[model samples]
Each structure stands twice: as structure tokens, then as C-alpha cells.
Target: MRVKDSATDPNAIAVDSPAGTASPRVAAPRTGGGTLLAALGVAAFSLTFPATVWALEGLGPWSVTTCRMVLAGLLAGACLLAGRVRPPARRHLLPLLTVAGGTVVGFPLLTTLALRTSSTSHAAVVVGLLPLTTAAYSAVRTRAGHSRTFWAAALTGAAVVIAFAVRESGGRPTTGDLFLFGALLVCAAGYSEGGRLARELPGWQVIAWALVLCLPVASAGAALSLRTEPVHLTGHAVAGLLWLAVGSQFVGLWIWYRGMAAIGVARASQLQLAQPLLTLVWSVLLLGERLGPAAPVAAVAVLVCIGVTQRTRS
Candidate 1:
């Protein structure tokens, strides 16, 4: 979000090492390639809710959660071995653990739980505010400052999303909404930390190592869940599970971190302004899930906030 104009922005922060030392700052990519990468990442992520719902059709939420994590971790482990990537340094472990806890475990589990009750379109719109949440986290973690205008737009966006949530549930937030909000918060933390970590290591390495770090616990959870959960695998379910593990969790993350490293977190996050809309389209086209009229309105409003925040971030 530093917008590659780092020299003019005194509040810009370099991605920090765990030893409390700042690493080299990532420069903005000279071409549109970074934007393309980020856009692709957003595209991959937009299908997440639909895919989770598909997986849930045949697999229990617990099984969906743990199985995806296990599969992703093994995939990541293979990538590390194939590339002979070094184990992360001792100082990197804490942040890596944070990444694993937030993205690999917390976000996946929470969103899957949320999907149990929430329609894909509903969940997608609620998650539309993630970029703002992530930007706020990034600013706080890096001690970056934003103008009043930036904060105002962010707040308005949050308020709009909140009102939408209440309206969706007949004046109260649903359990699914609560779980989606939790997923939003945890996933934001994971993303901010991962983007920062990517500055010090390859983007692929950052996510790969984080996924690998979750292997022991994820594997155990998968085993336990599989034993108890009644999984009647169907085409949609198997396809959904594979996409969750490979597309969203691994390949998408790898692409996203690289783009974030190149374009900076806040700037790269701007691409996600389209994600909810994309997800909405997918919900209709792929899942035959219809959305309330308010969904598009809320999405457009949030998009405005993101646009304003992007302009005012400097």
C-alpha cells in the first residue's frame, strides 16, 4: 500500500525481520506485471466460497477444513524439497507460525464453518471488506501513517459492510457472519505477515514454508476428522477439495505474495476490490445461488471506499 512512492511518503515501512530489524523495502514493479499477478490471485480467491460450499456438500466442515490443510501442506512440502529450499531461519519461526495459524488453520476453519449457514453470495459480500481490514493491519504492524481521508473511507466501508450484515440477518448478525468476520480478521493478519515475509524470502518460499510448518497438526486433524466425518465424495466435492488445497491455498498464495512483494501490500490489495463481485458472479453461475439486492449495492459501496483509500493512502 505504500504505492511505490516511498521516498515521498515518510511513513512507509520496510518489511521487518523477526529480530526487530527492518529488511530491504520492496520497490514497486516497473511494469503492469505485478498488477496482473495480483489480479490473478484475486480471481483464484473469488471462487473460494463457492468451492468450500461444494466441498461441504459431500464433506463435513471439519473434514473440509483439515483435509485441505493437510493436502496443501504436503504440496508445499513437495515444492520445498523439489527446489531444495532451505528451512527458515530461527528468527523467522515466530512470524511463520503466525502465518500458519492465521491462514492455514484459522481462516480456513472459520470460513468453512461460516459457509455451513451462509450462502456463497452472502459470504462473498461480507468478505469484500478484507482489503480494508488488511490495510489497517498493515499500517498498524508497520507503524505507517495514513491521512484522515484514508481512515474516513476505511471506516465508512466498514460501517456499510456492518449494516449489510445486520440487514442480511433481520437486524442481527448470524453465526455464519460471526465466523466470516473471524476469518476476515485472521486472514488479514496472515496476509500482512506473509507479504512482509516475502520481502525477506521468495514469495513461494514464504507460503510454502508456512504451509509446511502446519503439517504435523494439520495431518493429525485430518486423520481424526476423516475417521469421524461422513465423507461421501462426489465430483463437486473432490474438485472443490483439490482447488482449495492447490489453487487457493498454494498457487494463489504464492502468486499473491509475489505480487504483494512487488507492488506492496496496500497497492496490491486494490486488485481485490473486484473480488466480491467476481465471487458473486461465481455464486450465481457456478452454484446457482441468488443474492439479495443489497449484495451488489454493498459491494459497490465497499469498492468506492477502497478506491478512496487507494487515492488517499499516500
Candidate 2:
């Protein structure tokens, strides 16, 4: 689940540092470090949604969400146990829990279920609203000055949804779309809060502890679901599950948190503008989904919104 693009990508820590004339000697190393980390964060983040969709082909969204968090929790916990990283302080528990509950638990649960009925293309289109939602959230908090461009971008994003309904197979979104929308909203809120807190906490510590808190919750949900609905395992399913658990959940988050820490929340969220576009690309490639006439128009609209959000924030 994409949280609002954060300027504080936890992963960017290794890469970026303050420019102080007093620290001239460290400049070269900091620059190199920031560059590498930023690159890695970009690469890792790009794969998350596509990987989620790929995993969905085989595993139920609930199972995928549960397994990914459980495995990531274990992996992160092991690293923490080995002194590779440390846990958060007692006072930080609430924030950590919030991040875990919102991102690891809420977003995945909703997104997975959404994918059950909606096409990945539609999911991407709907998710394109995240930036706008984040902007709207910011508007509520800061009441920042607005512009005509801002409203235009916001309108375009809304247009994407309206367009979808017009072309919608049954002339309306299914129940799953509503579910995904709710999940996406939760995720937007998570991004806002998580990015804010990430400024203070180390990336690994946040993810590790957050996952630790989320593990039992996800596990219990999965187990209960399993009783009523048996998981159908296929070769694709097994591979997708493992991939999401290992790649997106464990490794991807490790880098993501780091990126959040390095840059800051708002700026990092900009990286997410790439995600929906990438999803569109992946859908065409992997799922054989077509873009049709709406493709270019949607692309322009999303890009314009991205620009609007950046300008408004800047």
C-alpha cells in the first residue's frame, strides 16, 4: 500500500546529509551515500504494487497481506535480535503501532480484497487519487494557499474515477471498488502519520516493531479465514506469496522506511507519482490489460496532478 509519498524515506538516510561547510570532508561520502540509497528506494518502491498484483494471482489478498507481514516481521525481528538493528523506545510504541496497523494491516487487507474483483488498471486509476487525497489532507491541516492548477489537478483525478464508471463493465464499481477506496483512504492517512514519525525513528526500528505488532493481528485474521475458506495453492500462488512476503514486504519496506527517514515525508510521497504509471505499464505487460483510448488522457491527467501537488507543496 502506498502511503503518501514521504520526503522522509527511511532509506535515504544512507544517502543524504546536511550541507555544512564545517563538514566539508564528509561531503563526498554523504553525496555518494544519498545517491545510492535514493536510487535503491526508487527501485524497491516501484515494484511494490506490481508485485502485489502478481502475488494476488495465486494467494487471496488476506493471505498475501497476512503472510507478507508475518514473514517480514520475522525477518525484521531476526535482524533486530542479531543486533543488526534495535527496537523502538517504549514511548514510541503508539506511533509504531499506528504505522503497522494502518500500512501492514489495513492497506494490504483492503487492497488485496479490492484486487479480487477489480482490474489492476482500475486499481491503479483509483490509487492515483492518493496524492490528491494527501494534498486534501494537507489542505485540512495547514490551509495552505491554493491555486487554479491545484483545483484542476484535483478535478482531473476525480475525472479518472468518473471515466471508469462510464466505461465500467456493469456501469458501476463493484463492492470491491468501494472496499479498495476505503483501504486507500486509510493508507493515505497512514502515509501522513508514518512519514511524520519517521523523521525521528530509525527506519528498521519502525518497520521491525510495527511488523511485530501487526503479526498477531494478521495471523489471527488469516487463521480464522482459513477455517471457513481453505486457501487454494497453485504454483503461481506459491511463488507470488513468497515473492510478496520476501521482496515487497520485507526488503521493499526496509528500503522504503529508510527513504522516508532520509528525505522527509512530503517529498518522498512525490516518488509515488511513478507508481500508478508503473502499474499501468505492468498491467499491459503481465496481465495483458489494455489501455484503450483512455490511456493517454489518463496519463496526462495523472501527470498534471502530480505537478500540481508538487507545486502546491513547494
The candidate that achieves the highest lDDT relative to the unseen native structure: 1
* Candidate lDDT (C-alpha), each: 0.77, 0.60
Kindly state the number of residue pairs that clash in model 1: 2
Any runs in candidate 2 off by more than 4 Å, and if so which? 1-57, 138-171, 304-314
The superposed Cα distance between candidate 2 and the true structure at residue 199, in angstroms, equals: 1.4
Q: Which stretches of candidate 1 lie over 4 Å from their true place?
A: 1-28, 157-172, 292-304
Which lDDT tens digits does candidate 1 get at residues 1-314?
Answer: 22333312323446445567666654444425766777899999988888998999899999998899889999999989999877988877887887888888888899899888877656764565787788778888877677888778777776776666556545644568888888889888888888777766777888899988888988898899999999899999999999999999999988888777766676666567677777877887888866567877887897887678656644
- Model 2 worst lDDT run, 10 consecutive residues: 20-29
TM-score of each: 0.85, 0.74
Best by TM-score: 1
Query: Where does candidate 1 clash, by residue pair?
Result: 1-266, 1-267
